[model samples]
Each structure stands twice: as C-alpha cells, then as structure tokens.
Target chain A: MAGYSNDHIASLVRPDQVHRDVYEDPDLFDLEMDRIFGRSWVYVGHESQVPEPGDFFCTRVGLQPVVMSRHSDGTVYVVYNRCAHRGVKVVNEECGNVGRFMCMYHGWTYDTNGDLDFVTQSEGYPDLEFDKLEHGMGRVARWESHHGFVFANLSPDGPGLREWLGENSDFLDDVAVSAPDGEVEVTGGVHRYLYHGNWKMQVENLIDMYHPAYSHESSSAKGGQQFSRREGDKGGIQFFEKRGKVKSMDGLGTHALPNGHTWQGGLPPVENMSEDHRAYVALLEEKHGPNRTREILIKKRHNVIFYPNMAMQELNPHIRVIRPLAVDRTEIFIYPVKLKGAPEKMFRDQLINLNRTHSPTSLVQTDDVEAFTRAQEGMMTSGNEWVLLARTGPQESLESGRIRTTGTSEEGMRNHYRAWLEYMCADRPE
Target chain B: MTKNNRSGDNQSAFGELLFVREVEQFLFYEVGLLDDRRFEDWTDLFTEDGYYWAPAEINQPDPASGVSLFFDDVPMMRIRFARLRHPRVHSQIPPSRTSHSISNVTAKRSGTGDRVEVEARFQMLDYRPGHDQRAFGGKYEYVLSRGDGGRFRIASKKAVIINCDDVHLPVAVPF
Candidate 1:
C-alpha cells in the first residue's frame, strides 16, 4: 500500500512546485471528495429552475446525489436524493414537479421539504422506532444563494457562502446584477457534456488562455471569419499560432485579482467586427441601458473557473458543472442562461452561435474534447512521471489570498496545484 | 349511377392531390441533404425567415425565457454551414459522416394554404478519425411551406433528442 504521511504531502507542495501524483492518485481523489468538495460551497442549480412550489431538480455535490426542491411555502430545500430505507435514489429524472417524493421500492413518502410524510406499512414497523423528524431526508450542511444561483456546502462548520466567495462575489454580482432588470433568468435549457480527462484539467483549461489559439485554432479559423484575414496577414503563423496569441486567450497568464478570481479580457479582434459587433452592443444597450449594459458586455471574458467545480463564461452565457466520476472520467454539465427581458431574436442568435460553435456537434468543442481525452489516455503511460507547473517559477507573485503572474504566465495552474496539495495533505478533522 | 360515379371520382382525385408519396420523397431528400453534408444546398431550401428549433424541454416554447437546445434563423444557419465547411476547423479534419432515415409523412390544410407536418425518425451514425462511431436516434418535426417555383422552404425544423440533458462531449458538427 502506498501510504503518504501528512508532512510528506504538505512538503511536496511549494508555491511554484507540485507532485504529478496529485492528479493521478486514486486515494487523493477520495480524499478531495472528503476535504475540498465535502466542505466547500458547491453550486447546485439556479432557483429559477425550480420556481414552482413542487418543482425539483437533481444534481450531484461531490459524489453525493442531491435534490434541490421547492417547498409549498416557497422555501427551497437541498436534501440527499436517497431513500432512507434502502438508499435507492428517490428522484432519477433531471427535473419535474412532484407534490411528494415517494420511494417506488418501499412506498416511503417524503414531502417537498424532504420531511417524511407517510409510510406504506405504519403498523408493521411498530417497534422500529423510526422517527419521521429524525429520518427526514439528510439535508446539506449549508444552503444559500447569490443572485439566484443556489449553492450548498457539505460541512456545517465551514465558512458562510458570502465569506467563502470573498472578493470573487463581486464578479458573481457583475454577472447577475448587471442585467437590465437587475436580474437574469435561465432562458435556454441546460446542455451537458462529458470529458475524458482529470477534473482538474478541465478547471485549469478554463482560465488557461494559452490553449485556445492552438486548441481552438480550427474553431477560431473557421468560426472567426472576420478575424481570419487579420490573423493570416499578421506576419508569420507563429505570431498568430502561439497559445495566447489572441487577446481573448490571455487567461493563461498570471493576471488575477484577490479572492482567487482571475479572467482573460477581450474578444479576438476580427475585421468588420468593430461595426457588426456594435449592432449587438446596441441591442444590449437597448435592453440594459448604456451604462449597465456596457459593464456586462464590454468586459471580455472567455472562462472563469471558480475553484472546485464551476466554470462560467459570460460571452457564452453558459455555466459548466464539473463532476469527477473517476480519475479518468469527468462529467461536464453546460447550462446556458438567457438574459431576462432580452429580445427573442437575441436568444435565438445566441443559441445558434453556441450550437454552431460550442455544441458537441460544433467544430470547436470537439477538438477540445478530443485533445483532453487523448491527454488522459496518454497520462496512463509510464513515460511521463509528472506534469509540469514550473512555467514561470520565481516570477509569480502571491498576495492578498490570490496568486498573480504575467498575463501570459501559468501562475493560475500553480495556484490550483497549491490548493490541491493543501486539500490532499490536510489531516481529516476529528 | 352517374351521381355515385361523380362522388367516388371526387374522393379519389382529392386523395391523389394530397400526394403522400411525393411528400415522403421530399422528406427523404431533406434528410439526405444533411447526411451527405450538402449544407449549402440545404440552406437554399429554407425561406428567408425560416427557423430551426430544438426545445430543451419536451414542450417548452418561447426560447427567450425557456432554454432551447437549438434555435437558429437564416443568418445563423448560414454562419453554421460556413463553419462546418471551414478548412482550418480542426474538429472537421476527419469530418463526421451521418446516415439519416425519415419516415411518417402527414399533410393537412391550414387556413391560408396547404400545411405539411411530418414526423421523421432518424438514426445517425457519426464516425471520426481515431474515435469510435457514435449512434444517436431521435424524432424530427418539420413544418414545410410551399415556396416560389414549387420549391419547399422549411418553416420550422425541431429535433427532439432522447438524451438531451445528459453530459455529452463537445458536439462540433451539425446533427
């Protein structure tokens, strides 16, 4: 058995260095489920998804299957989606409006709040001493919302949602509150995708602006028609082909704010876009007015990988949920949000854009999927013992609970590795 | 005998005019266009304002408020077709080949003109280089309109996938 001492694991994580086994280890994955995912605030689903009283949506928090339901009193509840009797999953469907959830196996019924309401054979269990109050569905330790997005933390003693979010809350507010009505609703339905890579790889890829110009070259080259001429004419291919050549792909650099928040700015500048994009901008201004609309639209961001599992992109209006199934398999759920009060045509336009570009059927997304899958397969080989995070080294700056590096630096990856090491090495709290 | 003959003749004539066989053939041709990657030709078949929609849920409309898997208009469709055929688009190096089949054509007359509504069941086998072929089966709802020169423009094309909500890999090509 490969046993790791606490000191040994902690010593492996330096500000700029980390062990490769952290990404490949099975024990570390389980430990993470307990330490990081088990304690941190994980996003569930948006409240608008379960607007109605009896509406419910099933999701996974770490490895635990959870159900977020709206009670008759209008309060939302997050409970384990398992039947107390035999641990059978109570809700199997993605979403539905059920007055009460009844276990099909044993006929045990629970109300929308996960309160046990009825049992099939009450008299048969005379001496079982099953208290409905005690046996109510196991609720998450903490459930809260920030701008209509619901999140739950598995640890009851951990930080509050706002405290946990810290400075990053501002970015969340910017995304949610900058809308015209100062509110945004989930317009497009959720789109889920799977990836055959380590969950961390997906998270790291989100802020790693370096890969898009290369990984998404095919997508940008074809889909980015207006920019094609500029990229082609911009001297040698090396200038345009570098990983972070495009301004939009600059997240790979070490530019980030306090509270572990970081983002790449601006879109790939394409010809004729200065005018054509203005039309889209005018539409946004019409909806959100010039000021707030400018705040939401003008800020260019490709992806914001919230530590642990959520990857959000304002440009795409989609939030992706990362669920690590195994060391090699990760499930990604993509939920597309529509700005409330926006024109129907605008939504249609976004849908078409995403479907043509991001959908599994899209040319851009497939290349990314293939690359990640291949990377996972390759890591299984014995040739490479460790993955490298030693990109910028001594140049990285650590300050105010955030790690920063050059705009083209790999400091974000180093930060994540540091956090991962902490989670893996920390002793289990008694 | 003359009156009875006239009634039977009218019934047969109207049935022939419905042209269910011709409608079926039209549907098959439409599927063939997509399967063969005749995207530009497919674009030619749509009216200027024609749309393609796939609901995220079973019966949710109003794509603005409710989520939709796809809701594309003419310009959007054109852009998609362009991307699919782009040379540098890496995902299409070993382009996806799809085989689709359509069945069950039903036509009825609406208020102004004849409206044809048909249900098409399709099983698409998508193959790419180094990746195992994936199979997806779904039902499609097409609303066709009679355009100029006896051509047909699709008013609406909705595909209801069986696994709409499942975590899927990036879908690069059009389904």
Candidate 2:
C-alpha cells in the first residue's frame, strides 16, 4: 500500500492487458481492499436471510467482517461485527436470531438495528462523556436493498445503489418475478470453500464461457449427458459440442453495463422446463400474464456479475460470492435461492442443480478451481509480465447506453479493469 | 445351510462376537477396493437401490430439499465412476491416491427389518499429483441388508465429514 502511487497503479491496467503484479502484489491488494471494496457497493446478503425481527447474518465487505440484521420496525441494518467497546466480534455464528448482540468481553449490548443499548458499569465513568448513541455498533456508511438483495457501501460518498446498478439491476428483478409471488428467499444453507488463487480469477471466470469445453470436458460429457437425458433435451452434449460455435455475439451475448457490472445473456444447459418448471411457469403466467411471463422466462440469463463480489445465476437460482482473504487466497460462498410461491419441486430441483454444478464435489466447478490455481501458479513463473485481455470479437453500441460484446470476449474484463482503475484513482473519502 | 431357527432372536441369534468380526472384515475389504482404485468392484458392494450421501452439514437430512456435499443414487454413482475414469477430467488427470484408516466400528439392528446399521470413524489421506496432500476424517454410517446368498449389500452409506463446513480443499475423490 505504501509504494503504489496513482501513476504506478494506473500503469498496471492498459486498454487490452493488465500487469501480472496486480494479482500478486500484497500492497496493491491492500490498496484495492481500501480504495475499491471500501468505496463501492458490496453485496451483503438477501433480505430474506433475516426476514423476521432480531435476525442477523455475518458477512464481509472487503476484509472487514460485518453483520446484516433486521430490527423490530422492519428496517435492515448493516453494521460492522466489531463491538464498540472492546472491538470483539459481536456475533460469533454465521447467522442466528439475536435480540441484541452482547459482546462477551465486557457486556456491551447493541440492538438488532445496530443501536447501542446498555453497558455494564456505566455509572462508574462519571466524568467520561461516553455518549451511547454515538458508540453503537459501527454501521456501514450507505446501505440499500434491491429486490431483497442487500448491499452496503463502506464509504459515505458515492451514487445510490439503484444508480450504481442501473440496467444491470433487472437481473435481480427477473429472478424475483420468476417466483410465483414475485419474491425469493435464501434457503438450503451455504456451501463455502477457499481457492488458492486471487479473487479476480474467480470474478473473471463467472462470465468466461470459454473454459467449459476444455477445462470441464469430462464433467460436461458425463454429467451434462445425464442432466440432458433427465431434462429430455439436447443440453449436455450439445452445450459442449456447439459451445464454441455459439460466439459471444451471435446466439447469446454480453452487456457491459456501467459501474463495472456485466451481464451474460444466454440459455443455460439446465433451462429446459420439466414438470416442476412448467408448474412455476403457469403460476408466473397467472400472476404477470402470458406476455410478461414469456418476456421474463424466455430471455434466459446465465449469470450477472455485480463486480468485486457477487455473481447470480438466475436460472439455476444461486449466488456465488467471492471474498478475498489474501493476495494468494480467496474464499467463496454459494447460496441457493428459493422462489417464495413456487412449487417445492421447482426449488428442490434448483438445489439439486446447484449442488451438482457448484458444490465441493461438483463435477463442473472442481476444474474451474484447478484452472484458477494453475493460473495463479503460472503468473508467478516470471514468464509473462502482461496478461492478455484482448479477445477480439463482434461488439456493438447498444441503444440502452451499454456495450454488447461477444459472450466470450474480454470486454467484460477490460470494463472491470477500467472501473477498478477509476475507483483506485478516485479521491479518497475524508 | 438351510433356514435357521435363530432368525427372530436378538444378539443371541447373530452372535455379537461373530457379527462384529464379519462387519469389520467387510469394511476393511471395502476400504482396500477403494484404495486400489477398483471403482467397479467397489461399486458392486452396494445394493441396486443404494445411496452414497455426504451431507453438507453434519445432520442434514433429505438432500432433495437441501444441498449436500455428495449425494449419488445408483445411476448417479455410475456417472461419477465413469467421469472419474475419463482421461480428460482436468481435476482428476493425474488422479488422487488415497489411504484409509477405519476404526471404532459398531453395529446395531435397525429394529424395522433385516438390516444392521454400522457406524465407524474414518481418516483418509489423499495425495494428488502436483497438489498438497489432503487429510480428511469423518464418521461413516452404513446400513447393510442381506442380499442373495446371505451376502451383505450396502443399502446406504452416509459420510458426515468433521470439517465439511470449513474451507475445503479440492475433493476429487469420495471420502
């Protein structure tokens, strides 16, 4: 963090390439933890995670552990997990219902909404001006929820969450309306693991459709075939055989939205409607009518990367969150989502697909982890100074003020670096 | 060799000493098959409708409703075996070598049928080429039922890993 000046930081990212040092430098990683993750809107969790009052879920914004909680008045709060008194982590478990977080150290309490409640031996400090109101559990600077997915900004300055999200926010809407009641819930527990690689590798892999044919050849052949047979569609084999043929531009495409957000729109392998899927479609048809339902369900989207941390696969109904523990280590948390009013069978099937693709023993994801770690290892070999991001392909200026590129193009990566540079060079919050 | 009159009795019928030794030998044999990478022979130890489940959480029930670390019915297990044998699986290219140590085995009648539920603790050391060695320990619950010729076949095998929730290393092979 000490040696990285603005010019040095700016030199790492070019129009078509990035320096390998960005992925390896501890100081630069620390700088990103401060300048990028510290200022941007970091996704915390779904509102449904803490639906009732007094519920809290522990998460992280950058390297800082924070808790999202629901108060009695139906308000959600994103507070740093550290206690105001002794700086101890107030909530220990991953998630639970707590009336108030009482720090085990000295019995300092904070309400579910992150307001300071009581302190032990308060009267002893007579001359000390300890205002309890100012000493509550430290809350994130700015927080908001879009369609139940909550995000918090560590720095007070920046655009609102809606403006930051812009058109990319529709991805969440699509997921919500796909549910019968136009709502979704976070259920089925969490599957988390650590990869021995940089966080950006996983972030990039989220939208990179180029790897499946080669990296996941066996799984796509074996598991995909079984999955396709079950769906009674030409999904498994056709996906691998014709995957490369379907360029990022032609059949499906990518949209480089503002604020480093990117969306990959294409039919996923598991999009085929089974009986349960049909039932959910019927419910959607009744609720939103046929035309809107078709619009919602037909325009299939594989996943949406909200930059830095979250990637949501709407069709599969799960979110992959990346947390950078260190320059060489990253942790991932996958949460499967359930539509509120959808049939149990639909949610059940979604969980099955989620586990089959992304779990620890997943047929598809294990290879991706291998590639990421290998890439990390290769970068350290002193062979290449510049990593290429110049996948030339068809790109268009969209009417919606977004850029459309081939689904496999490195345009999304370039866009991400552009945003990263912008955030890094921006004026620091006072 | 014909039907015996001890069928309806308790420990007196199965004879606790013989039952314990038999189950221990069966588990040891199964371990050898897995360690030797004889996947097909290992798979044959299961009944036709058998399940191999490793829950994400320690006490997670019904993988259909929740996520699981590994849940394979008979056909799904076949697909896994086929995938493991494939030459191009990048994760398993050099393949994983495993050595297992199973102990603390105990068996009890399931109380509903002719099945005995066996419980044991297992520690497996997995070494994959070009990767660090991974050590995994867990409790194994196996329900065994007598099949044709009075041979025991696994109705279900559930592995509850102690560190399932911890940040896991790559799991290319079943624990």
Candidate 3:
C-alpha cells in the first residue's frame, strides 16, 4: 500500500470519482478512524437510554470503547471505557445501572460522572502525583445534545453540534413535533447485522435512489408489483409502471447540506389501513390542532444520513448506526424510535415494520447487504481503479447552503465525498 | 382448540405412543417440504390464521414489543416466497440448500382441548454454492390443530434460537 499523505489522499477523490483503495486498504481505514471518525461528533445513545442517574450505555466511537453514563446531577458524560489504572475495559456488559465504575483488576473506582472516587492501596502510588480529575477515565473532548439525541466529539476543535447539524436539525425538529408530546425516544431493542463490505457502501447506498428500481427489483417488482414491508399497509412503493416499465424516483429530489448531510425527499405516501394510524393522528390533532397536524403528517425526508456513523429514516422512525470492524467488514445496528405520547398500537406497528425492513432476516435489507457484498467483491478487479459518482441532474442551490438535485442523481454521494476529503486532509486532531 | 381428531382413545398408553410417532412423522414431512424447496406446499400446512415467529430475544412474548428475526403471517409469507422465487433474486442466485433435522420431540394436550403443544429441538445446516456452510439450531414450540383428514394444521410455530440476538449475515431462507 502507498503511504497516504494529505496530497495523495486529496488526489484519490475527484469531484466525480474516488479510488477503490479507499474502501479496500486497511491502513487508510485506520487513518480514517483517527482523522474522520476521531474528530467528528459521533452519535452515542439517546438521552432516554440513560434516563436515570447511574444508567449507562457502552458503545464505540470508531474503534475506541466509550461509555455514556448519566450522573446524579442529570448530566450525560461520554468517557473512555478503559480503566484508568491498567487499561482494562471498565464496563463489560452492554449497559446497566452502576452506582460507581470500579476496575476489577485493582479496585480503582470512578464516579458516575467519571471522576476518580477511590483507589485501592493509594500508598503504592505515593511516588507518583495522582490527581482525581486527571487520573479518572478521560472524557471525550466535547459532547452535546439536540432534542435528547446526544453526540460526542473526540476532538474539541470543530464546529459546534448545531452549526454542524445545520438544516438537518429541522428534520429532527419535525420528528419531535410530530409526536403529541413533542419529543422522541429510542425505546425498542436493537437489531444488529453484519456485512462483508465497507461501511461507506451502506452509507452511500442509503442515498443512492437510482439503484432501488434495479437492485431491489426482485423484492418489490417480482410480478411487476410492490408489497409494503408492513403487516396491513394499504399500498406500497411501485417499482414498475402499469405498462411494465420501471418507475422513476427522480421526483423525490435529494437534498445535500454541509458537513456530509444528505436526505431524499419523502417517499410517495402509502396510506396506512391500520387503526393505530388514525389514533396517532387524532392525538397529534389534540396537541397541535388539525391544520398543524396535517402539515406534521407530511414527511419531508426519507432517510437522513448523519455522516460517518449514523443514518435515520423518518418513514419508519429508526436509526441505523454504522460500526466499521475492518476495511471489508461493518456492523449495523437499527434502533426503533418511538414518538412520545403516540398510541401504544402505533409503537407496536413500528416494531413490526422494522422486523420486515431492518432485521437481519428483513425482506428489504438482505437484498441491500447482498449488493454491498457483491460491490466489495467487484471492486477487487485490477482493471478499473475508480468508482464513478458522476451522475447529476438539473439542480438548484438553496439559500440554506444546500443543493437540491434529482433524487436519482448521485449528488448526495458526491456531497459525502466532498466532506470526506475535508476531514481526511485536515491536520490530525488533538 | 378445535376437537376434530380421533376420540378419547388417545388417553391410553400405547395410543399416546402412536400419537408421538405420528407427530414425529408430520415434523419430518414438514421439514422435507422445505428441503425440497416446496415453499408453497409448506405454507399450505398452516391454517388461514397461522403464523411463523422467530423472536430475536429469549422468550420474547410477542412481535410487537421488540424487533424479531421473522414473524410471517400468511400475507407476509406470500410476499417473502414470491421474492425468493423471483428470477433475479441476487441474494439467492446460488440458492441455499438447507437440511433441517428435528429430534427430542414431545407432544401433549393443553387446557382440556385437543390442542396439542409440541416441542422439539432442531438444527438446520445450510449451504450455498461457494459460501461458508452454516448451522442454526434452536428449540421449536408449536401449537397444532386438527384440520380436514385429521391432519395437523399449525396454528402457531415459534422457533427460539440460542443466539437469536447475535449479529448475523443475510439469511434468505426461513429457519
């Protein structure tokens, strides 16, 4: 492999193309963990996951183990999961309420807010100057929350969470307001699946509307018709026209914002035949009134990619977290998002729909994973070194500093590569 | 809960033995349909309201509470099998060949009804042409009802695998 300098890395990504090595090289993958994921505001768990004091959730930011813990003062702290003493991983279980984090190796303990609380045999460390704050599990450089959705940045120097979020914040706002209680929570258990492909493949695929009609033909257009990925939905996305030609998603328009954020225009609506939807609408009307409720029901974005690590869909209301294990392996976790004050049946329907769409055995996502695996295999050919992202359509630059292009265009992905280059070429973060 | 089967004679010892053998045969035949790739016929063994559930959590009470690996009602099964049979199903281009084996079978009447609750352990070894062969094993809990011809029609079938919550690759075929 070539030693990737900033200039060489910049050369690899053109405005419309990228080299295959970025997805296949282990060295570059490690560099990205440090340069891109290491500096970005990677999403941790939601505020609801650690609702009570001492509640904790363990997860990864790039390859580093971190814990999101709720302290007695009602603050969430993102701290390194490693023991301050011997580098042993402090939290072993996925999540639990711990009164205090204690290292099993030598009995060093830290407070729920990650301050050093106790240390066994303090006399042994007399030769060394040990301060409580300096010696406790080091916190991430910065962390912030928007609508109870928490994100932590490993590097302190960067745009604040709100500035980085930009127009994407409105999407979360829409989600929160759609709920009768004006909030959302990550309630349902997670669905984790693995794919033998680069993490970028999954991120790129979510925004690539052009491939759906062809790639998902078997799942949606088997008999030149469509099937909703739910139990009792009245209709579904039609991949084929009545005359048997493929339908076009170009009207759905993809919006590209700053900081690698992109979202496709809402999918064509499928009327829900279930009574839960009616109850949900009624509750929203009770809270926000009829006219506002009508506006709230209109979904503006299909899937919102919070680049580098997470993507979310307002349609089914779920978040997908991308964890890269290697250059060729990635694990994805899908968590169902519950709109607060919605009908009980509505949340149940959400879980049921995720089973068909996001689960490992999902009728929809399995085909996607297949395409990703095949793309990984296909990129190994030595003939072509570049993967194309040249597709474009008539686009409008919005006042909000976003580009709106035909949904089928590759603008969303091209936008992602632009942000990718900026992060990869920046000087190493502290 | 329908009582369409042979009379109270099943209460006798030898008759119970005969009943167990019959259930074992039905299970063997049911899985044989899957091995032969007769999905349409396999689905026929279900009553109109019958469902197949593979929960992601241990002893998951219902599909509504959390995500499930699979929970297919008749309509869902139809769509799933239709996609599986589609000519360009890329995931199944080299179609998986599964050999399912079930043993340690037990069957008994529940709640003063002819409704037989059957339990068994199963291991399905699946192989696709150039991919790694995989084994999936779990305990099966089935609620059976007697339909026409006194044959067992599954009212509900639940398979709780040991690693139901483990991160898995794409699984096209049903377990």
Candidate 4:
C-alpha cells in the first residue's frame, strides 16, 4: 500500500493539476462521504414536495436515507428512514401521504414529526424503560431553507445556512423572488437519471462551458437545422446562438463568483428565442414592469452549483441533487420547477425545452453523461497519476474566501477542488 | 367526476370520430413517419404555432409553471429532427431505431370547432447501440385542427407517460 499524507495529496492540486486518485480511489470516496457530505449543507427536497400534512419524500443525505415530511402543523421535518427496532426502512415508497410510518418487522409507528406515537403490544412493555420520546426516529443535525429549497447537514457543528450560502444567497433570492408573487412552487414532478461517473464529475461539468460546443455538437446542429441555412460555417456558431437566447441556455461559459458561486452567462441567441418566450417576457414586463422583469430574465445561468451537492438551473426550472452511491456511480435526482402563475403556453414551452435539451434522452445531456462515465472508467487505470485542471484563467479575485474567474475560465473546477481538499483534510472536531 | 353536459356531448362526438378507422389510419401514418426517421415529413403535420408536449406530471393541464419532459414548437421540433439525423452527432451514430404501436383510439369534441381531443394508448420500442431497447407505454392526447385541405394538423400532442416523472435515460426521440 502506498503511504499518502495530506501534504502529498496537496501537492497533486497545484493551481493547475490534481491527482487522478482523487477521482478513482475508494478510500478517497469514503473520506468524501465523511468529510464533505457529512458536513456540507446538502439539498433534500423542496417544501412543495411535502405540501400536505404527512406527505413525505424519501432521499439521501450523504449515505443516509432520510425522509423529508410535513407535520400536522405544516412544519417540514427530516428523519432517518430506518426503524429503531430492527433497522428496517420505515418507508419503502418514494413518496406518499401517510399519517404515520409503521415498521413492518415489529409494527412500531412514528408520527409525521418523527415522534414515536405508539408501540406494538403496549401491555407487554409495561415494566420496560422504553420512552416514546427517546425512541423517536433519528432526525438530521440541521435543516433549513432558502426560499423553498430545503437543505440539511449531517454534522451539527458546520456553519449556519446563511453563512454557508454567503454570496450565493443573493442568487438564490433572485431565483425565489423573481416570481410575480415572490413565491415559487415545484409544479412538475422530479426527473431522475443515473450517471455512471463520480458525483464530482457531474458537478464539474455543470460549469464546464467548453464541452457543449463539441460534446453536444450533434444536438446543437440538430437544433440549427430548423433555421435558415448559412453556408461555410460549422453548426457551432448556430448552436451557441440558439442556446445563448435563454439566460439559462447562455453559452458564455463559466463566470466564477465569490463563495464558490459561479454563473454561466450569454443568453441563448435572440434568433432562437421562441415566440412564446418573447411574448412571455413582454407580458412579465407589462405586469411587473420592465426593469424587474429584465432582472429575472437576464440572469442567464445553466447550473448554479451551491457547493458540494446542490445544483440549481433556472433555465429548465431544474434542480439536481447529487448523491454518490459508490466510487463510480452517482444518482442524480432532478426536480423541474413550474412557474405557478405563468401561462400554460409558457409552461409548455419551458417543459419542451427542458426535455429536449436536458432530459435523460436529450441529445446534449446524454453525450455529457457518456463522457463523464467514460472518465470514471478511465481514471481506474494506472496509466495516469494526475488530472489536469490547468486551464486558462486560474487566478482571479477572492471575496470572503471564495474565488471568481472570468467567463472563459476553469476557476469553478479549481474552486470545487479547493473546497474538497479543505473538507477532506480538516480534522473532525470530537 | 362532476359532468358538464355540453362539454361531455362534445367530448363523446369527438371520441366517436376518433374511433373511426380513418382517424386511426391518420395516426398510424404519423407514427410511421416518426418511426422511419422521416423528421422533415413528420414536422409537416404540425400547424405553424402547434406544440408538442410531454409533461412531467400526470394529468397536468398547465405547462408554463411546471418543467416538462418536452415542450417543443415547430422550430424546436425541426431542430431536434436535424440533430437526431446528423452524421457528426455521435449519439446518433448508430441511430435510434423505434417501433410505435398506437391503439385504443378515442376522441371527444372539446366544445370548440377548432379543437378535437383524441386519446390513444401507445407503446414504443427504442433501440440504440450499447443499450437495451427501451419500451415506453403511455396515453396520448392529441388536440387536432381541421386544415383547409381536410387534413388534420396537430394543435398539441401531449404524452402522459406511465413513468412520466421518474429519472430515465436521455429521451432522444419524440414520444
């Protein structure tokens, strides 16, 4: 076995290069689950997912399967999915409205708030010191919300939600408050897909703007075929122009912001803007006035990685939560948000765009997944010892310990690596 | 369900029209164009402002607020077809082979001359290299318009998949 130290690992991460083992090592994956996932504020489910009393959605927080539920009084709660008696999962279904969760093995029931309501055969445990309050379902260390997006932390000692969010909080505010009523509801159900790559690979690709012009060239070309023909030009410009119209589809690459927040700029080309989108923007301006509507419309971002696991993309009204299942496999749960008061035509337009561009069967996204999966498979080989992150524009301004890079920079990936190292190397407080 | 009589009558008439063999023939022809990968011809079946929508939720009426699996207009649909048939498009290198079966045709007049709602159950088999053939079964809602030439043009094609919201492999083809 090769003896590795923090210093040795740190050497692999220069301003430009990273060790290949970071992507391939099983030991490193475990360290990530404990250090990164164990402490970061991981996104759970939106409040709308559990709107009704007793409505719950079961998902993962790190390696733990936790259920997010709404209580009788409308407060949302997150609890361990496992039962206390025999360790069986309390809820087997993905989502449902249930007054209480009963363990199948022993029939112990817990209320929506995760409080133990009753035990099977109460008379048999008369002399036992079983306390219903003490034996309730296990709750997460911390749970909070920014807008309606819910998140939880497994470690109790991490920073508060506001502090962790830092500059990204402003972006979150824009996402939430941009709506006409300043309230957003998850209108559509979630879209789930599996990536045969490391969870980090997906996160890295979220801000990697360079890949689309090449990897998604086919889809972009496909999109371009609808427009009038322009001679002597490969479809790259056409794809970029088309994608650049929507703020969400902006092909501007990565704009690294402070606090590990980054934005992809350049609206999809105006030429490709749908008639409905143009009309909707006009109507939004008419209703909310031009300035406010422009602020919402122009903040084009493909995906905003809120550090670690939560990624929000307003373009598709999509939010993806990454849960690492193994060293190589990652499960991404995608939630597509619906603008509550928007016109049916507008909503339909957005959905079609999302399915065609971002869905599992999307031409662009499938190629991306295939590339990442191949990367995961390739990293397993002993051929290369390090991965190169040394792309253009690594050094940029740092605000409050966060880094920012220009539009065509790889700083987002470096920022992610920096955070990864910080979490992985830091000694846990006992 | 609370029955609205006028709308119900319109719906029944529309359903009766859809059950006719001619309507089924029209649907079969449309599916054939798609299955044959004749994208340009497939797109000609839509009106200028027609929409193709596959919702992420079951029985979801509005598309504006919710994220849809797909909501494409004529231009977008044209682009999709172009890419699916593009040679440089690596994902389409082997190309996706699909077979669609449309059955259980039912139609209803939706209280408007411009609108006729036709419902059908469809099963699609899609195959590509290195992946198993994926089979999708769903109910289709086609809102059709009567063109000047007495042919039907799609106003809206809405597919409500049985596993609509589940995480799936990339959906490349129009369902």
Top candidate on lDDT is 3
Which prediction has more favorable lDDT, 1 or 4? 4
Interface RMSD of each: 3.3, 1.8, 1.3, 2.8
lDDT, candidate 3, at A97: 98
Instruction: Report the C-alpha lDDT of model 2 over B1-175, residue by residue, as the tens digit.
Output: 3346445455465588788888899998988888999888888989999988888886687787578887877877777778787778787878999998899999987776579999999998999988889899999999999888877899999999898778776787788
lDDT of 3 by residue, A1-430 (tens): 4468899999889888999988988898998898888888898879999999999999999999999999989899999998888899988888889899999899999998888889888998778877777889889899999999999999989999999998888988998998889999898788989999999999999998888777777767737235665535654566788888888888888999999999987844545546777787888899888999888888878689998789999777899999999999999999899999988887887887888888988877888998989889999999999999999999999998999999889999999999999998998654
What is the two-chain DockQ of model 1?
A: 0.37
Instruction: Tell me the whole-model lDDT of each prediction, alpha carbons only.
Output: 0.69, 0.83, 0.87, 0.74
Give the winner by DockQ: 1 or 3: 3
The DockQ figures for the candidates are 0.37, 0.60, 0.62, 0.38
Q: What's the TM-score of every candidate structure?
A: 0.83, 0.94, 0.95, 0.80
Task: Kindly state the number of residue pairs that clash in model 4.
Answer: 36
Over 4 Å off in model 2, which ranges?
A221-226, A229-250, A268-272, B1-14, B111-113
Which digits, one per residue and each the tens of the lDDT, describe model 1 over residues B54-94? 65566665555444555677776776677666676565667
What DockQ class does candidate 3 belong to? medium
Off by over 4 Å in 4: A1-15, A25-27, A219-261, A264-303, A314-317, A337-349, A377-382, B1-28, B46-51, B62-65, B102-120, B141-157
In the range A74-139, model 2's lDDT, one tens digit per residue, is 899999998888789889998889888899999989889778898889998788776655788887
TM-score of 4: 0.80
After aligning candidate 4 to the native by TM-score, how far in Å is the CA of A153 from where it should be?
0.7
Highest TM-score: give the candidate number: 3
> What is the RMSD of candidate 4?
7.2
* lDDT of model 1, residue A209: 56
DockQ of 2: 0.60
